[model samples]
Target: MSTAYVLVEQNNGQLDHVTAELITAARVLGEVTAVVVGEPGTGQGLAAELGALGASVVVAAESPSVTGRLVLPEVDALHILAAHNPGPIVLSANLGGNEIAGRLAARLASGVLCDVVGINADRTADQSIFGDTIQVSAAVGGASPIYTLRAGAVAGEPVAAAGTLQTLELPAATAKDVTVVSATPAERGDRPELPQAKVVIAGGRGVGSAENFKTVLEPLADVLGAAVGATRDAVDLGYYPGEYQIGQTGVTVSPDVYIGFGISGAIQHTSGMQTAKKVIVVNNDEDAPIFDIADLGVVGDLFDVAPALLEEINKRK
Candidate 1:
């Protein structure tokens, strides 16, 4: 049977949720083999969890010095391992994964199914694209086809599977030219990561000011245990961090529920968040474009509606 390699991601010894989702998708394709690129202390029981999720092979490279270094070794490993025991390759279609996918496809000289929402292999490789528009079936040339899966696009299910562990120890490659810099993780609440969050509460310019924005959206996210996002207008006006923006100029997310306040939906803006499973729009203008795609819409002044909504949510809590 063909083997599918799922590159595992761990932060502070805990597996990233995207890795779990990838393993779940791998079960639908073929035998799953997990690859972990970190020091021994990082994975905890993540590997075992992946095995329980149907991964039959687990590969580890425990290099302490190489732990956070952005090196080309990952792409190099893909070329080396797949050359001898060639099969399907799976990676999270996040920012980091896209970089590795590009390098691996170039080095391996193979076709890449990138930003693939879902993958199916019966007679051909069928993949769903971003922007909620296209689905394409693809073929590879001489090498095994590499694929990158979108976050939150598929449900994760893990089955019982005994895994064979392998460690391919390669000599450390040259460090990246970028200088070592002090790293500080941003302070956030217990909220879920933005892309992986099931619920997203967002703001826009209509919230009036930076202070007003927190009044409207943050409370809702807190109630829902959701991540906070902003429209390009809110981001440009400095009402929220640029990282919180969720339109064409911002991050693309497919959360279960998305709430947009005061944002006039431009196609560019919608292009990023249109994949959301449910959308709620609150704006003073009933004719606003954001309302066009909203499953639920409220045509009222945000200044009046937001406080009431916040109070109701607080009362419910």
Candidate 2:
């Protein structure tokens, strides 16, 4: 079987939620080789987990440079691997992943497919384009096809493999590379990360004010244990932080349940959450565009409905 290289994304020590999905996607192509670019021992640490997730081999490219600098170290590691054992490379379709994919493709002179939702046996991929209004199939004609898969696009299933460990030393950083002097981790609340959350509760301009987001939406989210999201407009209006924005210019989410409160259903926002397994929208405007795709729609004021829902859920709890 051909080898499929999956770039593993991890933080601190825990593997990112997308890593399993990437491994699952790689299985469709051939034997899975999971690549880890981090500090020493990172790959060894994840080998068993990777094997459990269907990665037959785990290539741990450990070096201080990986954490000390930006993007280049990962590119260097993948480039070196491809030089000897070239195959399809799969990465998460996030900001950093896309940049790495572009750089790696340029270095290898290969074609790349970004934001791919599905990969077929024939190697063609399904992509949602034009703000997700169009679904198109894309194929790359090259020795190596680098694909950046959208988060939550593929569900991960365990198919155990050997998970043999291989360590590679990354080249030393050069003057051309950017260096990280210091960093401060963002304070993420107790809620699960938005992309990986099974349930998400999003608010919009109709949420009224920042206080309402804290009072109305947050209480609902707490009851449901759902991640909180906001439309670009809500973010722009300072009702929520930009990092929590869900739309074309922001994060793409595919939760099992996506609940939007007071959103107008703009294409930009829907495109991000359209892949959600079940969509529920609460909008006073019955004709709101969001209702077009909602699995459940409630025509009511979010402030009123949200509190009642929260109270009822609290009762049930």
Candidate 3:
């Protein structure tokens, strides 16, 4: 079987949930070779878990440059690996992953497929395009087609493998690379991360104000243990932080239940949450487009509906 390189996403020594999904997807193509690029000892720590997830080998490319510099180190590391054991390269389709895939593809002069949902036996990929309204099959012309898969595109199934560790020497950094000056971690609240959350409560411009997001939507979310999300308009209006924005340009979430308040159901926002199993929307506007896709649509003010929902849920608890 051909070797498929899967980039392992990690932060502060903890593996991201997407890494397992990448491994599972790569297994459909060939043997999985998980690649970890980070500070020294990062890969060593994650090898066992990667192996349990079906990675046949773990390539740990550790260096101080990885922590001090930006995306260039990753691009360099993957480029070097592709030079030797070239195959399908898989990565998450998030901001950093897309950038790395694009740069690496340019460096390797290979074709790249982004936002891919499935990999066929013939090596073609299935893509949801045009706000996910269209499904297309894509194939790369050259060897080692780089793919940036959407999160939740594949469910991970564990099939144990050797997970043999292989250390690679990263290429020396050049002047072209950007240098990091300082790093400050974002303050994380108790709520689960938006992308990984099983339940999501989102708001839009109809949410009225940031105060409303705090007092109204958040209370309901807290009761349901759902992650808080916002439309681009809400974020732009300063109702919520940009990181909480859910849209085509923002985070893509596939949750078991997605409840929206005051959203107009713009295609950009709907595309992000389209994979959700159940969608419940509340909007006073009777003709809101979001209602078109909602499993349960409530034509009522969110301020009234949200607090009532919160009270009922709390009463149940």
Error of 1 at 237 (Å): 2.8
Off by over 4 Å in 1: 41-44, 122-130, 175-181
lDDT of 3 by residue, 1-317 (tens): 89899999999889888888888888988999999999889999999999999999999998877888888878887888888778889999988999999998888889999989887767899998898889999899667789998887787788999999999888878899888889998899999999889999999999999999999988888889999999999999999999998878788888999999999999989989988999999999999999899999999989899988988887898
Q: Clashing residue pairs, candidate 3? A: none
Q: Report RMSD for candidate 1.
A: 2.6
C-alpha lDDT score of every prediction, in listed order: 0.75, 0.90, 0.90
Error of 2 at 160 (Å): 1.4
Ranked by lDDT, the better of candidates 1 and 3 is 3
Q: Where is model 3 more than 4 Å wrong at Cα?
A: none
What's model 3's overall lDDT? Answer: 0.90
Task: Give the C-alpha miss distance for residue 9 in model 3, angstroms.
Answer: 0.5
TM-score of candidate 1 to 2 decimals: 0.88
In model 2, the clashing pairs are: none
lDDT (10s digit) by residue, model 1, range 75-110: 766667777787778898777788888887887777
For residues 203-283, could you state the per-residue lDDT of candidate 2 as single tens digits?
A: 999999999999889888887989999999999999999999897878888899999998999999998998899999999
Winner on TM-score (1 vs 3): 3
